[model samples]
Target: MKKYLVQFKPFLIFIGTFFATYILLTLIYKSYLNHFESDDVDEITRIVGYNVDLLLHAFNSDVFIQKSVSNPWLEVWYNNDYVIRIVEGCNAVSVIILFISFVIAFSRKFKTTFLFILSGTLFIYILNIVRIALLAILLFRYPEKVHLFHGVLFPLMIYGVVFALWVFWVNKFSKYAK
Candidate 1:
């Protein structure tokens, strides 16, 4: 048992750090929500949703978008029609948490890891907002392909970016890479 434990120490450490970071972050986010009266989307999520609405409107001025962030829910209006409501799940916070965890697990130098995590998080955040905006547009334009676009393609796009980042880290930046 001791010998096997020694052999798998690095793997164990990675698993432990990943879970700890993910769980701790989740708890803190939840705790932050406790301060709010309404059970709407958290502040960060609201900002993301708002950004999505703005971006969509910018691309298509005729879309006539409005954000109704009454509580935690953010409803995007398309020409007075409530086209989409962004919930917590759409924020991509969970995805960022998972990305951070994996990067930390295979961390390199402190500065390198910190910068990578920061930049990667930002990239993911921007990509997610864009994803939401594009999704709204695509859904509006092609209501028939909701399942293909939202259920399949969008998820693959996000996950694909994360996977590529992981591969880059493992090959270029991670300690194991050297």
Candidate 2:
């Protein structure tokens, strides 16, 4: 048992650190969210919706997002048609949290880790907004394939990027690399 434990020490440490960071950040985010009324969207989600609206407009699409009166989501309207709801999950904070957790688990130098986390988080956030905007436009054009685009393709894209970032970190910057 001791031999096995010694052999797996690094892996165990990586797993422990990853979960600790993920849980801590998720709890903090949930607590922040708890401050909002049930009928009101959290600030992060609202900002995501707003950014999606801005991106859509940049593409010359008739787009606007408004808080839904009946639910804690933003209604995204494209070309005067109700297209999709920008819910909290659509905000991608959870994905960012996961990304940060993995990066921290394999962390190296403080400056490098900090810069990577900051840049990675920003990149994920921007990509999420672009994903939402593109999704809204695509949904408007191909309402028939909502499941494929939203459920599979977009998720694959975001998670794929995060996975790539994790791989890059491990090979290029992590302590494990040394």
**Ten contiguous residues minimizing lDDT sum, candidate 2:** 50-59
Q: What's each prediction's clash count?
A: 2, 0
What number of backbone clashes does candidate 2 have, counting pairs of residues 3 or more apart or in separate chains?
0
lDDT of 2 by residue, 17-130 (tens): 999999999999999999999899999998999889888888788987999988999999999889999998999999999999999999989999999999999999999999
lDDT of 2: 0.95
TM-score of 1: 0.90
Q: Which candidate is the best by TM-score?
A: 2
Positional deviation of residue 135's Cα in model 2 after best superposition, in angstroms:
0.4
How many residue pairs clash in model 1? 2
In model 2, state the lDDT of residue 59. Answer: 78
Q: What is candidate 1's lDDT per residue for 42-144, written digit by digit as tens?
A: 6777788668867876777445433354655777665565666677788888899899989998997999999999999999999999888877777777878
User: For every model shown, what is its TM-score relative to the native structure?
Assistant: 0.90, 0.98
Cα lDDT, model 2, residue 105: 98
